[model samples]
Target: MTDIPLEHVHVAPEDGSDGEPAPAVFVLHGRGADEEDLLPVAAELPDDRHVVSLRAPDPLQGGYTWYELDLSAGGLESSQPDAADFRRSLDLIVESVEAAVDAYELDADRIGLLGFSQGAITSLSLLLEDPDRYAWVVALHGYLPESHADLDPDGIEGKPVFVGAGAGDRVIPDSRTSAAVERLEAVEAAVTHGSFPGGHGIGPQELEAVVEFVESQAR
Candidate 1:
């Protein structure tokens, strides 16, 4: 759909809806990965909802990145994001979701977000910026952006969230994911935090947990 803001791959529900508004989960890929990068994960999602996997706006090392990394404060693994690019990408994602709501006949109240690495960072930021806009979130191998520290947590109360991390992840540490979980918990969000043994990528255990979390939320 041209009206939708970002370049994406839209997967229809496995089961036919017969014109009813279907629930939707918007998928965002990690840095240097395109919209197609996370499509395999979509196969595990509940069969009754729409899956929209979005490509980042900026081109990067043959793929795309939501924002440039700021490495002045630390090494590549602990680097921060360029504030301008990060905010722009966030706004664009918001617009994309709003447009998709009407374009895809999605159930606005059941909107969910699934993201990895940098994508996970953005997803969590979106939830914090306007917690009521999303029904649930799944963020894997990512941390909360520093710019979102002043969020109003009231709207996030009881919202279901799945935070996953790799114990051996060098790019985004488990500590970072834990910090995000703590922040969400402080807001009274219903959060499920998990850590798998691996390095910088999703494993079988992580994927299974993700599917289970989404299935529970979908129900």
Candidate 2:
């Protein structure tokens, strides 16, 4: 267990246009990556929107991980099982996002969560834990939380969700991908799922689908 302060960075559109309320996206990177890892992906999104790429709270040897995984405790891969710690970190992230939204006068209903790998897992967890926090969620190369059984889909209220996974992803098995879809559907989320030909990564097709989903939600 190591203690490291969470870090974050933001990337705004290059154009000098400003507005009373600017739509924004909260971008989370995969495990072993920092806020900078997702900066490039933000550029691929619609430039008219504001993008904030956040770093994980805990620092790893060369990167960062949102929570610790305990394979030693049976088959459980818990995410910072310490409830208080998890909530504290999650609160920090959420607070940062809300502050940014307020500063930009962005419509809360237009904000979305976009994450890859572990970040995707976190995005799903956050959406399920607090449905009204985000209007849309985009998860890439990740599976649903193991504790999906405890979630209340009715809380989601038909929020739009986009899930993209590789057909042959070894890290996140196809079965897990299917399970994730089922869970989202059960929660009454308006889901759009896409499968690519690669493994544990995002491709041009996947990115295109994500862009389309975000644009639709933004409108």
Candidate 3:
């Protein structure tokens, strides 16, 4: 796969202002999902925040993936990501975010990221790697990989972060959630984590909380 994600789309604001650059949100889908998967969530975000949904770089069975998964260690909790592709995808996402800012006249200082499952892993990976690059981050049904070690957690201070997970999620266990929280705390991030009643997918309550987070950060 190329170092760039293959597909993307911009969800423009209906009441956008002329000349004033709008704040933006980048939405990423989980494994086995497409760019169109998060469009409904995009449609629910605060109207002032422009949306960008991206497809993963590496194509899987019928869908796409940010990186290859290695579950040989057993269970989803012990899974590993292909280091090379993960880094490549991160580079591509950063490039895309930069390009989106320039092309859409977006406010770079106010950009937030939202991701689900594998998408969430990629999003949090980027945020932790360079905490200064994002205004906020929302990680859903995902956890931070122990392999990402170049981060200065202290730089994430005051940065808004929301971690939404399903209490009954067999895909992501509580151990992973706790580990993610510990990692984020080490960096001093302003975090809001919520666990709802569900499994591996996003629910209405999750959406509402995540939307509130992005909207609050955009303000």
Give the CA lDDT, 0 to 100, for residue 34 in model 1. 98
- lDDT tens digits by residue: candidate 3, 21-135: 8888898899888889888988988888788898888778788888887777887668978788888888989998888888878899888898999988988999988888899
Candidate closest to the true structure, highest lDDT: 1
Candidate 2 lDDT over 1-219, as tens digits, reads 012234567566556355546667888898788888877777788776778777888888799877666454444322323444445656767877777776555667768899998788778888888888788899887776655436984558688999988987877665666678888888688889989888878888888888888878744
Per-residue accuracy of model 1 over 196-218 as CA lDDT, tens digit each: 99999989999999999998875
**Candidate 2 colliding pairs:** none
Positional deviation of 137 in candidate 2, in angstroms?
0.5
Judge candidate 1 at residue 100 and give its lDDT.
Answer: 94
lDDT of 3: 0.84
Write down the TM-score for model 1.
Answer: 0.97
Segments of candidate 2 deviating more than 4 angstroms: 1-6, 14-18, 73-86, 153-155
Instruction: Kindly report the root-mean-square deviation of model 1 from the true structure over all alpha carbons.
Output: 1.0
Candidate 1 wrong stretches, greater than 4 Å:
none
Better of 1 and 2 by lDDT: 1
TM-score of candidate 3 versus the correct structure, residues matched by position: 0.93
